[model samples]
Target chain A: MSYGFVAPYTALVIAFGVLPALYAVFLAFTDNEGGFAGIANFTKVVSDFRFLPAVAHVALYLVIWLVALVVLVSFLAVVVHAVRVRWLSRTLRFVFYLPGALAGASSVLLWLFVLDPTASPVSGLLHLLGFSSFVQVIVPANLPPVFAIIAFWTGAGGWIVIMYGALNNISPDVIEAARIDGATAVQIARRIQLPMLRKWISYMGIMSLAAGTQLFVEPQLLSQASNAIVPNDYSLNQLAYQYAFQQNDFNGAAAISLLLLVIALALSAVFVTRGGLFEKD
Target chain B: MTTVDVGRPARRRNPARRRNSVSGWSMRTIIAVVVAIFVLFFVIPIVWLLLATTKSAHALIVDNPFQPGSFGDLAANWDQLFGFQDGAVTSWVGNSALYALGALVITLVASIPAGYAMALTEFRFRRLLLVLTLIVMLIPNTALVLPIFLELNVVGLIGSPLSVILPMAFFPFGVYLTYIYFNTSVPRDLLAAARLDGCTEFQVFTRVALPLAAPIVALVAFFSFVQNWNNFFLPFVMLPSSEGYPIQVGLTSLLASTPAFNPSSAGAQSVQLPTLALATVISVLPVLIVFLFAQRFLVAGMTAGGTKE
Candidate 1:
């Protein structure tokens, strides 16, 4: 009976998840004619002119994105939770979570206009920063921060919601006890709540880091808007796509993707083992 | 700490608590200020988007971006937007609904049962299956999209709706969430009692357990729906034709046609900034509605990851 219940999902997972992953490994190590090419594909992809820049771009974006997501999301979640009024707290959460509805491609397209100083609602701020046009705002040096802002706009709210829920899950009795011991709200928040949220913070960090590495839609679209001002291979995923479809270098694409998969899996493995992500009660 | 203990006899603890409360009031003020700034950061862009739809392309640049334009301009923009490619926007919306809802059904059917069996039953390879689900869930979906595309290409399913829907329906996170929910919340004794009452395993699940899993069902459904609807990479890769484009992918096409952004590519039917903004608003409306209605389930889904009941 259990097998009957589990069969459908298992079939799909094998077909979609397991098979594709294995297929990627095969493609990465093979030449175009199905002959084993060893690590030639990996070396070629790593040595591509765009490879180092793509890696650097993704690394820079991930660092900024992950740090902002961790710091700001946690701060907002903690602050919103501390609000005494029930309705006020609920409102704050709702407002914070509102932007999450605009994930991925839609948000990216919308942000093109937001980054345009002429049409931006916050043009005053843009003017203060001395950016007068969309092109000026989205210069190469600004792409990482630009992508980070777009990501944070659509991503941070969900984390705040998750963090707030984790905050709520903490036992109020423990907090009450702390308050009775002469701990200020700030002290209690730091010493008590934040410590309890360590696992969750790490969980957020790991998940966000994984997502941050897959920065495709933002840069891909920006490349179109900027007329190749943002390089076509501005991210690793874009580079992989270029290799696969644009260049018809499936082996190279597969090798790059495998490298990414290894990075993601290795980092997640570290977090899973160290963070006790699968701890049983 | 010593001072507080020593002053307990002098009734000084009350003053200390009072002092803490005073500081707490100041802390609240600072938090409010910070939260308000964040609120502006989030709200202003959306507000600009909504207001942009009411203006002409020229006015959107020249006028105050926050100001609402005339109703006539909004009507004109709406007409121009809906009029694009003889109402391609409508077809994109339909495509998005079809893909999202189709995947949503499969996700619910597959994930719920798989999660239930894993969490509640001692089946062979259950631990292995759970571990596989976690690993897949942890691996970002985009990382798998290209590989999945390759596999689908070999099978000649590329550009088919199944190419998008089938891959999307394989939502490992939903299964993990369901597994977590059933493991933590559902009572095994209740199932055991149902079995004693002459219920088969299937009956125990269908009648006794499934009803109790409504919140989780809604949570999984909402997430699956949102993920499927907001999905861009999968559909963008799968559908080679604009005719099959979902709204999210369609929005990119619209962005390219907007004269302000891509003047070299713009033609007679090029999109205006206001029309483009309206298209964006239209694309987001369904997700926004679902989010508002499923707010309760959303909170449940958000909390499910790292916390126990």
Candidate 2:
């Protein structure tokens, strides 16, 4: 009976999730002719001229994005939670989450105009910063911060909402006890509320780190918008894509993906175990 | 979960309340100002995008970016957008709806029962299955897209709609959500009671457990819909033809045709800024509408993973 209930989904996961993952591992270890090539694919992928830069770009972008998500989403969620007016708090959450509707590919598409100094609503601000065209704003040096901003615009709001909910779950009795002990609102927030949120904060960090490592759509579209001024291989995922499609190197593509899969799964395992993500009370 | 106070205003105005050493009024002002500033940062881009549809391409670049253009220009942009590739925008939207809805059905049917079984039943290898789901859930879909594409190609399923739908339906997050919901919320003794009353396990699930799972179902459904609707990479890799493109992929073609982005590719059939912006607005409208109506479920879905007991 239990198997009857679970079989359909398990089958799909095995077919789609487990099979493709195993296939990637197999492809990574084999050459084009299907003979065993061992670590050659991994070595070849790493030796590619574009590999290191793609790694650096993704690393830089991940740091910026993860830090911003932690600091800003927590700050906004705490502040929004503090709002006394119900309607105002709800409205703030709503507005913050509005960008989430235009996520990924679409958000990146819309932001081309936003970053274009000639057509942006904040063109005056752009001009003040000495960016006169879209190209100036989307330079390789600026891609990390630029992608971070687009990501935060569409992604951070969901975190804020999640963080706000976590905040709401804090017992009133504990806060009241702190207040009775002469803790100020600031002290309560810093020492009490923030401490209680440690589990949630770590959860956010691990998850965001995983997601940030897979940054593809933003840079891919930006590379297109900039006429490939931003390198075609601006991210690791894009590199994997180029290997598979452009160079017809499935083994290299599979190797890059397997490397990424290992990192993501390892991080998740650490968090799930140490962070008590699935622990029953 | 503990019920926290929301700091109601009426309670703050009470004379008996202890005055803080720090100035509370000034703190309130700072928080309000900071939140307001962030709000402006978020709203400005969307407002500009919305207003861009009303302006001509020339005016969009020349005039004040915030200035509203005439409805006439908006209508003209609309006409041009729908007229492109003989009304391809409508077809792309239709395709998105079909794919999203199709995948959503599979997600619901698969995730709900699987979650129930994992959370409630004593099954062999349940722990293994749960761990696999978590690992698969964490593995970014982009990383899997290429491998899945290769797999589909081997079976000659590439370029077929099933190529897109089958992969998107493999939503582990939904299973995780339903699992959590049943584990934390559903009462075990109640199931036991039903079982003792001569109801079969499946019957107990369908009658007693499933009805109580409505909120979780809605939460899972909304998330599945949003994810399926917004997914770009899977469909982009699988379907090579432009006619099979969803709106998200179709927007890329529109972007390439815009001379502002692609000067070399622009021809007589090039997309102008206004029409391009209009098309973007059209693409996002369905999700926006669903979001407005489903805010409650959206909140539940976002918070589900974080607020565990």
Candidate 3:
């Protein structure tokens, strides 16, 4: 029976997880430039045009996504803990998490309408201010940030909900004791409550890190509204995509994906071992 | 595993002086302002989606937006969406449901038993097995997309629904969740007592542990279902044929192909923006409905392992 239970999980991991991971890594080392050229694929991936920009795009996205989630979740969590309005707090948490349920493609589509100058109400306001064309509202340089805004709209809520749940882990008496010590609300939170929740915050950060690196869905969809102007090889995942899907270069795609995997694994290992990602300190 | 740490509240302090402080008022004002801005950002997209779907492709851009509700235009636009490409979107939705439901069933069967075995049995390599699961979880799902596709291609299962569904079924998150839930939530002493009563291990698990695993059963079901249902990338890659496309992919393909489907502003990209908007609106309805029913279970069940018990 134990073997029976293990059978399905084992088969799946081997067929879909372990085998693929090993095969992809091996593929990355090969030069399947139309056919096999052995180790040339890895060399090409490292030296490819737009490689640095791809890395930079992911780096920039990570910085913005992590900062936004940390700042927003912590702030909202602090406010909820201070106010203690049960129903209102629950409602707000619901509103924040609802966006997460929407898929990335859907969120991107939603933003396209909101950003459309001719139809958007804000664009109407912009028109009244003599800014008619979308070019007035957004330019090429600011486009990635606009995509990041769409991501935050859909993701920041789930983190805030996580923070709320984490805050509940803090004992009520502790907050009261800090109050008795004449510590201000800000002082109590920063000095007392915040320290207690560091492990959770770390886990969220690490999880966010893994998520931020996989920035394919947003950029892919956004490129449509932006008229494919977001640069086809803008991010590593997108570059891999354009290679495999657009150019039919599966070897190059596998190569870049392996690089992404290494980066993700390194970050996740740090959290898993020391940041209390799955256990209490 | 029951912590039962109900620390009492600190003693009362005077309240009259607290209400008059400027810091309190200003902080409240700041919070209110932030809430207003953030909530508006959240609300606008959904409202725009709803409103955009209600208007015809032409009226969406040409008209002065946000007029009173047009039940007529919504019905008409939906009729066109389904009838647009001979109702392909409906087939896509059906395909998505089949894949998500298939994966969800397999995830439950595989993960629940794995969780139970990991928690209860004194099996060899338990620690090694646990570490393996953790490492697997760390390996980002997207990074493995290429390798999985290759594996499927080698086995010639690329276009099959099983290609996507089989992969989605191995949810490490679900396994880890069950591990933690079983570790903390269940009464291990009850199992020991059942053994003392001459009950076999399987009987103890089936009779006592399984029934009490209610909350987690629901939690895993919801997460597994949602992840599979909302998944776009794997299906997009595996199912080369549009016939096997899920709703999310179907919607995206429709959005991508919309400019040709409609001739509005053939010269400009902005003209077809509402097509994308309508696709977004239709994609979220199922998840939203499922979430409303399952959210309470999600919150309570999540509190166990996710927050370190």
Best by DockQ: 1
Return the clash pairs for model 3, or none: none
Lowest-sum lDDT 10-residue window in model 2 chain A: A272-281
Candidate 1 per-residue C-alpha lDDT over B1-309 given as tens digits, one digit per residue, 9 for 90 to 100: 997677576655477777767887887788788889999999888888989889988899899777799899999999998898899999999999999999999999999999999999997898888877877888888888988988888999998999999999999889988898899889999999999999999999999889988978888888999999999888988899999999999998888888788878778889998999999899989998898777677766765655353
What TM-score, to 2 decimal places, does chain A of model 2 have?
0.96
All candidates: DockQ: 0.68, 0.67, 0.54
Q: Rank the candidates by lDDT, best first.
A: 1, 2, 3
Which residue runs of candidate 3 sit more than 4 Å off their true CA positions?
Answer: A33-39, A124-131, A134-139, A279-281, B1-20, B62-65, B193-202, B260-276, B300-303, B306-309
How much is the lDDT of residue B3 in candidate 1? 72
Q: By DockQ, is 1 or 3 better?
A: 1
Candidate 3: lDDT over CA atoms? 0.73
Task: Compute the lDDT for candidate 1.
Answer: 0.87
How far residue B102's Cα lies from its native spot in candidate 2, in Å, is 0.8
Find the 10 residues in a row with the least total lDDT in model 1 chain A. Answer: A272-281
lDDT of 3 at A260: 82
Error of 3 at B60 (Å): 3.0
RMSD of each: 2.8, 4.3, 5.0
Cα lDDT computed for each candidate against the true fold: 0.87, 0.86, 0.73
CA-based DockQ, model 2: 0.67
Per-candidate TM equals 0.94, 0.93, 0.89
